[model samples]
Target: MEFGVFATMAEALDAANKAQKDLVNNYSLEQRDQMISNVRKEFEKINDELSNFEFEETKFGRVEDKIDKNLGGILNTPGTEVIKTRAFATDKGLTIEYSAPYGVVGAVTPSTNPSLTVIGNGISNLAAGNSVVFNAHPFAEKSSSIAVKTFNKAVVDAGGPNNLVTMSANPSLATLQEILESPYVKLLVGTGGPAMVKTLMASGKKVIAAGAGNPPTIVDETADVERAANELYLSTGYDNTLMCTTEKEIFVSNQVLDRFTNAFVESGARLLSEEEANKVRDLIFVELESGEKVVNKDYIGRDASKILSDAGVDVEGDPRVAIFITDKDDLFVQKEQLLPIIPIVPTPNFESAMEWAIEAENNNNHSASIWSKDVYRVTEFGRRINTSIYVQNGGTSAAFGVDGTGKDSPTIATPTGEGITDASTFTRRRLFAMANGGNYIL
Candidate 1:
């Protein structure tokens, strides 16, 4: 159980290689489906255990939402979907084309989605006929370990290789490096910060690096202010906005600013008092190494009441949400503050709002949202910012399937590059060609 001491990268690779060979050697398509089904059942059994671990360890989102993500991973993270294959008889003989697994996969899980990421990536890699060696986030070690155990049990029960999915019992910087440098690791799939993604990309290996994001949600004059406020509230509060697909900033047209703010306040969000706002501005903002003030990490994902209390302000009511009304110039509006706090910036018009929104979004280049009744306005805004996901008439969480959004799994912070970490997100494709009747050459 103590993966830190016993589970070296070499051991992980050897186990994974054996699993891959077993998959190619023993299991046919029928066996693969049976294994997939067994894994899905095991996921259901461990759902509550993983959900509890995630809530206790990360404290990032709701327990219910985490459970939903676990189930979604089991149900919809993609399976073996084969494209067209061909066989032909040539003058020389017969030729056939087929797809095969890429051998051992090196996957790194993120803390924000500990259980869901493990299950999703595990299922995807299995479907691709590859074995996996996961480097889970240190913060969610218990959850990650349980996930690995559950997967391994499922595989073994289904007549597949044991340890087909392996992970370090205790993930650390040293363990991560060993996994990256291992020769048996054929490909890398990462979901973490920019530093980690950059490290994986530089390892001289094939990597599917999922990076970071600063998503923005836009509300224009033509928007349904009430619906937009409701959707935004749901998105920003879903699992405390842990998802990279969640809206990090809101850009509202001056025409609808007051209406949207009022609606937001009516929906259990509290506007910080002037004195309290000043305290938050001091406590939440800090100077970076470049001497530029930025939102402090201490407040990120902390409850609004706790943030205010730490800033020496006390509130009588139960207020979980923080509303900051500031100009676009404020550091609060211009950055990806990953807390329950929302900054509402007003622009003169829709055009100006879109421009300001894009600027506020900055380099994160992830996802954005819009709440508009006008189809043209939605289309225009989608065209303008050009984020990975441009949600209309809904919160940013809609991109990830929470609160009646489209049916999708939880997304990783690496939105700009890989978007979401789904089944295909963890795979690579190769083309196979066969000559029919003639020996042809270029």
Candidate 2:
């Protein structure tokens, strides 16, 4: 039998509402900890299941990579950290500052990293003492439901409310409206495209919308070309580049472009044949809804050989998809093609490279990658670009603990004015003051 088989979004919402009421009236810190433990355990059990579902449903990333992402959410992403309370005695007697839950939370999950996103947000919300109502993407409803069910079962087995984590079976336009319009939902978190973010912001409620990103990775002449190429390939190949923080474009200095290209090719990357390259260009550079040419989904996440074959080209063995040495003014350089294909743009110097890189990034502020030994150059680039993560000497994925020191969380693209979404991002602070036999000035 398939995993997700719930009745409807309304039924799920009702159940979650009841559970939230019960939790507010009876939940405890011990139970909360138990829920976290259960969530972690369930994550392990369903890791394989979610991975299979993602590959079967979306086919946009590798199953192994997906498993890693889901596991990371369980192990990291700040679970159950205390925000602590402090009391200070002043002329007005006593004042205290404490962090509290925002009641029931409504979260919109995206298809790119379905299970991981839900698990990460759900764990954070539970740690912050809030119940959640998750509205999964229509394309990822099954995986999303499985994650929610697994999480809720774990919570219930751990002495918490059964429906503490709830989700809709079939999420539609009307169901999303219900969630957004419901006054019971205290906080709203969305992860997807620009339209979704815009809608959440216009809902007249507090929202954390993780939106679109077109990150540019700049490689200067002074950088280690081999290391930069390796990092770039690994980051972009991670889950087939489903991550918004993945390096979308490459800006290389002319002095090192040839060397960098050689290094990239040596790292199992093959340049596309003329016929294969043309096919990729046609498939990716397609007409958008507004009549603008955009990258199509067919080419996204496919293996190089498969992409070439699909485009009616035959190769002896596994051949990389379209790879081209192009000028910065080319359409490919300006566009964010979420596929295996990468465009190498040459710039005269660091200044020109940085300028083109920033323009290519287009101020998405999601993430950017830089490879330079010069401390000042890295610092200067970091200061100029307002990205949530500026990864130096590595790929964009490194920022999310992919191959770096940071803890893993689906790097929130919207950033929502908050650089990173973790434990503190899920709660609000409230202050208490007392006036005991002390006169205070107004």
lDDT of each candidate versus the true structure? 0.73, 0.77
Candidate of highest lDDT: 2
Off by over 4 Å in 1: 1-6, 82-99, 288-295, 316-320, 402-407, 410-416, 436-442
| lDDT of model 1 at position 122 | 79
lDDT of 2 by residue, 1-442 (tens): 2122347766666777777778767877667777799889878887887788877887777788788878888888777664467776766677777777888888888877888887888887787877788888888887888888788878877878777777767787777888888878888988877788888888899988787788888999899999888667777767767777788778899899888888887776766655566776776677867988877767677766676667776655653333667777666678776676777788888888888888887777878879999999999999998788889998776666756777666537454876668766777888777777343434
Q: What is the lDDT of residue 161 in candidate 1?
A: 74
Q: Per model, how many backbone clashes are there?
A: 3, 2
Please, what are the lDDT tens digits per residue for candidate 1 over residues 270-343? 78766777888889888889998876766666667777778887765756567767777777777667677777
> Residue 9 in candidate 1 has what lDDT?
58
Poorest lDDT segment (10 consecutive residues) of candidate 1: 1-10
